[model samples]
Target: MSTRTSETTVTFGHPFRLAAIGDAQPAGTYRVVVDEEEILGLSFLAYRRTATTLETPAIAVRGGPHAFHRVDPADLEAALEADGKAPRSV
Candidate 1:
């Protein structure tokens, strides 16, 4: 079985950033950059590409112009395992 892998090198911190490259309701390609490690994912919008790249007015949210459903490392591991695309040790 072949696998797919993506590489990201940004560590995440409080108020990390996520980039969705498509719609407003998150329905397309997405990227989350945290701690220099990027996690590629999907969404349900088209214009939400900048969801995590800026500051929005609080309490005036619009259901993501582009956003990522925060995922835990363990869950991420599971995803990588499922696809057999986890990075290898050098």
Candidate 2:
């Protein structure tokens, strides 16, 4: 099996909470990392998402080690939608 990773940033206009994170997070841009595995034995190449994570403390925060929390894609999308930001496809 083969895998690949992708990273992107998401901005929240208001504080939000993710079930996985267990706390309200401040409004800011956060780094989102996604891991996908390549599907084999197919006529067309494709990938399936294996995991998704959000960087805690926002990316702008400094002076501390950032923690990545595994988050559900739907939960993140709902959070973003509630924040008035369209969730970008990860």
lDDT of 1 by residue, 3-89 (tens): 333334222122222232122221222343332323346353222112212222222345755434444444433333444455422
What TM-score would you give candidate 1 relative to the actual structure? 0.29
Residue 23 of model 2 has an lDDT of 82
**Per-residue lDDT of 1-90 in model 2, one digit per residue for the tens?**
999999999999889999998889999999999999999999999999999999999988988878889999989999999999866685
User: In candidate 2, which residue pairs get closer than 3 Å at backbone N, Cα or C atoms, i.e. clash?
Assistant: none
What is the overall TM-score of model 2 with all chains considered together? 0.95
Tell me each candidate's RMSD, in Å, in order.
15.9, 0.9
Query: What TM-score does each of the candidates earn?
Result: 0.29, 0.95
Worst 10 residues of 2 by lDDT: 81-90
Per-residue lDDT, model 2, residue 69, is 95
